[model samples]
Target: MSVDILIIEDEPGLSRMLATTLGAQGYAVSTAMRADEALARVAVDDPALILLDLGLPDGDGLQLLPLLKQRCQAQVLIVSARDQESDKIAALDAGAEDYLTKPFSVAELLARLRVAQRRRQEAAPVTQCYRAGELVVDLDQRQVSLAGEPVKLTPKEYQLLAILAQAGGRVVTHAQLLQAIWGRHHSDDTHYLRIYLRQLRQKLERDASEPRYLLTEPGVGYRLGDGTA
Candidate 1:
């Protein structure tokens, strides 16, 4: 059976209310009151989306956020009573796709769910291989080559390259690329990107100083060059 929603909230009343409300909308909903239970449920249910609460009986949900993101394919939307900006940022940076403070309206929750689902759909890959100039990226094969010569890459290097190639020449923001490769916690870690980008240019470009295919957008982000020499 397909599970669309998993509500990982400790409060029985709130969990039941959310389950009832979402079930009424024709979504298959599951609930877990503890962190371990939620992890097990996620393993079994493989829900498309999760409504998580940070304050749990057994553990802090913020600590569990990265684990959940690593283990599950679900888009986590944190619904918690923690209203502090730090809490919100920490949850988000820990990989929660979105954060919702408690006492939230059902309407807003549903709307945000819709937005998350839409974004997921948009981000889904439509193609496997991307080509620009002499560089060829076969995403499915997890390989990159230049001028038909195989180019070995570290996992992180390939990840950064794949993200840029996936953009199809459009600029991918530093934050977006960082989050995609290094998790949301490192979204501001541009130094990592810079170091990796430099390495990628060395391997893939004939001239690392004047990069050909890996184009930087200065203050914005980076994108694959327009297949031009």
Candidate 2:
């Protein structure tokens, strides 16, 4: 499963920005504009981290903070325009993991997320070179090959293929692949997958029209096979 995140910001533009930014980093993101909606999402989605704004259309973020904390185990990171010291103290005391005033840098936001998620990832396995049939993925050296020859791939194409390679022949959902590539920006966009997969097969397969390795799982997702199945 992918890392899940919720952005509780009301601004459409900013919400989209955060969702897309986080989504591309391999997070499964959901958004809520109102306090009630936020609460419902918290109870359902159970996000790993919540990026909250102090001002909501239905209620003050501060007033809703305690309610959110009481219901879920997520780490709340307040992203607000309120920069007063007292405001910060109240939020921290109310159980926020961290706070960032408005107009924050994306770098800092990502850094804070890493810190919040560090503990959960303390035992994740290190990625090693992978091989299946004629395909070879040397993640450490950042290279891929088909059969005995090198195959050139665009950065996005490589990312798409690497994700499948890492799946170890198991099917990876379409949403997972899209989120990793463009975040939530390409939700329900099947054409993106078609284009990239076609490109990958053209380079990796002996005949793109009759793919032997990149197999589609009907309505489910895609899987990589060693062409022996």
For each candidate in turn, the TM-score is: 0.60, 0.52
Candidates' RMSD to native: 8.2, 16.3
Candidate number of the best lDDT: 1
Q: Local distance difference test, per candidate?
A: 0.85, 0.81
Top model number, TM-score: 1
Off by over 4 Å in 1: 127-229
- State the TM-score for model 2: 0.52
lDDT, candidate 1, 79-188, per-residue tens: 98888866765675566777789899999999989977865664566667887788999999999999999999999999999988776655567778988888889978
lDDT of 2 at 51: 90
**Residue 118 deviation, candidate 2, in Å?**
1.8
User: For residues 174-213, could you state the per-residue lDDT of candidate 2 as single tens digits?
Assistant: 7678877988888579789999999998888877877778
